[model samples]
Target: MKLEIAQSTPTAASIAMLVQEHYGLSEVVESEFLRRSFNQVYRLGLTDGRSLVARLSAERPRGAPNLQFEAAALEHWAEAGCRVSRCVPTAGGEIAIEVPLPEGPRALMLFEHLPGEFTGDTALDIEAFARGLAVLHTAGESYAGPESAYRLDLDYLLQRPLQGLLRAPTMTAELRPQFEELGERLQAAILALGELSQVLCHGDAHGSNNFIQIDAQARREAVFFDFDEAGPGCLAYELAVYPWNLHPRTVDGVLSDKAAQQWRHFISAYREARPVPDADLAAIPRFMAARQFWLLGEYAGRIPVWGSQAMPTDYLRRQVTMLRKWETLELPL
Candidate 1:
């Protein structure tokens, strides 16, 4: 009987071979495993002292079309002069190469490695990062590419995750009802807001995905990468991600002084590049709740491949506690 495999990690040697064969980069000296989460990433070193990143997407429900959407968006953004990690086309001019593995076919795409450091605690760094995100939003507004398989809508952000939590064996009976109630309340609140400004959101805009560097004028600028979660979504939802990361895991969801300061600087800087309507600004907190739910679902959905250790019972309980705390906060953006 043939054994079933849920996932497989392709060897670094195989990745080097693929890069050389498909990308025409004969100078690749090393291919090292960078990290693994939803997707596997590798860092490739070239003989010319340049570097590249190769991302092998895990088996996504949307398959190759989804990868294509990502590629197209990156290309579009790059053309618009946004500091994005540009995708390198294969020898055949394909944006992504489909490679069959033991588990399934994963899309492999290479990108030019960007230079800069992650945003720091300083106001300048935070502001630059915020401005970069605003630029991305502005650039994405003109995207006329194929529709993304995923949408950062209520179903993807709220319902699906809530359902995943409900199905998790670790979720206690007491916690299940709480999640459902919160989910319902969040959905209702969002729906009550009616229509909102939509843009191609860098779904994971939580500061860390961006790099900050000072330009010739000594002004900090940001270059963004890791757009794995990007898609068309509400502007408020896109802005909410930064604050959600800043939110401390406390019972009373009040923003810490540092968090509040960072948020103020970020929003102020963001507004300089693009206008954020009062309605969208006000809706940010609610969208933050939705982000939490989306994350819960993402982790739960990955349990089969990642295992229970990633989302232990304690972590779930802490997340629920945070959700409850978030409900209590009166954040006025």
Candidate 2:
């Protein structure tokens, strides 16, 4: 009988060989596995001391079409002068190369390695990160790429996560009703806000996705990467991700004054580049809650491959607690 594997990590030696063969990078001096989460990432070092990143998609519902959408969006954004990480074409001039793996066929794409550090929560860093996101939103207005297979809509953000959470074996029975009620409340509140501005969202615009570089003149620049979740979505959702991510970092489980001020700076910087409506600003809190659900669903759905330890009972409870805290917490926006 053939051994069934849910996922597999290709050795760095194999990756180096593959990159040399397909990408025509004859001077690859190092190939190292950087991370393995929703996808697998590898760092390839060239003899000239330059590096490139190789990302292999895991088995996802969106499949190759999603990658195609990302590649097209990246190309479009780069041409429009947005500081985004660019994808490297294969020797055959293809943006994505398909590789058969133990689980399934995964799409592999090489990218120009961005040289910078992840942005911190400092005011200047937050401002620069926010401005970069705004630039991306503005540039994406003219996107004429292939239609994405998915959207960050109510179904994808709320309903699917709710379903995944409820079906997870680790979910507590007592929390089931609470989860259902919260999901309904979130859906109702967001729907009552009427229509929101739709744009090509970074989908995962949290601070860590981009790298920040400061020049000798003290000018800050951010180069964004990881467009796996990029697609057409509500502008509010895109902006909410940063503040939503900040909530869990506070000591008191609420937005600290400093965090609130930083959020204000972020919004102000973004608005300086692009206009955001009052209604969209007001809808951010609701979308923040929706972000929590999206994350819960993401973890629950991946439990089979990631295993139970990744999403222990305590972690689920802590997430639920955070969600509850968000319901009563007031945001600066």
Candidate 3:
């Protein structure tokens, strides 16, 4: 999509006008609600055979200042014939339009709705998906927008280890001592691992952030979205989260042998696509611990698990247990 002269940031009236101007349609006869996060998305059906998505960013100034990066990324992918969304330019030849926000302005862009579904709960085509990831990771080297940097580190890990433990009323006296022991071991482990690992990483690669869908013939396809957390970090650190986070819920949240199996499978596939150095592999166990500690620290204290209809209780219990397990696992490095 080409950049065009900016309009007054979109309003309901402006969007209605914009859609008509671009699509040559008289009205938005119907809309299928899509997603509601920081931004609101809807699939708009037009009088013509074509359809388009309308994005209404939350009225916060500078919250979503532009969609330039997303447009560039998707356009680059599609131009390379990658299976991804194709950006559609508005009638005025602009890919994005600034919308009025309370503070300043938010930006909106429309994308050709791509096909896919959630990479279901288990046995997802991770191997195939890893191949796609390799393509993205390697191709992404040409990207110039956001500078990737390691966002999760040893200090960040240490700051939050005791969080969830402190919340569990059932946390026993023995567990308290265990937590202390875990903390010391983890501190040492992170220090040692830090000496060996660093790289451009996906700060968040948990399965939930990905989409897995089948085409008319039942062939599976994967698309990873939500790049907000993509930044600089240890590639090993990023990869370690895949297996543990893939669990539908965290009963103990510990890195069990079961979780390790998932890791082995996924990593084995990923390695085939792009071999990880032994030095990085040696540091992964400790990095996994740091990730768990980071999670417990960031959420357990503030986010309540009950009645939110979100993840199950056992899931969290498992996560806490996993953290303990991670604390004990020795890194190869």
lDDT of 3 by residue, 206-321 (tens): 66556677778876666665543444456677776775474333434444665555566667767887877776676666676676666654444323322222324455455557
**Candidate 1: tens digits of C-alpha lDDT, residues 2-88:** 888878999877998888888866588988999988889999999989999999988542233367788889989999999999888
Candidate 2 runs further than 4 Å off: 61-65, 249-252
**lDDT of predicted model 2:** 0.85
Q: Which parts of model 3 are misplaced by more than 4 Å?
A: 1-29, 46-67, 86-95, 101-104, 121-124, 145-188, 194-204, 212-221, 248-251, 254-262, 282-325, 329-333
Candidate 1 C-alpha RMSD relative to the actual structure? 1.8
What is the Å distance of residue 37 in model 1 from its true position? Answer: 1.1
TM-score of 3: 0.61
The local distance difference test score of each candidate is 0.85, 0.85, 0.57
Lowest summed lDDT across 10 adjacent residues in model 2 is found at 59-68
TM-scores for the candidates: 0.94, 0.94, 0.61
Candidate 3 Cα deviation (angstroms), residue 117:
3.1
Q: Over 4 Å off in model 1, which ranges?
A: 60-65, 250-254
Best by the lDDT measure: 2
- The TM-score, computed over Cα atoms with residue i paired to residue i, of candidate 1 is 0.94
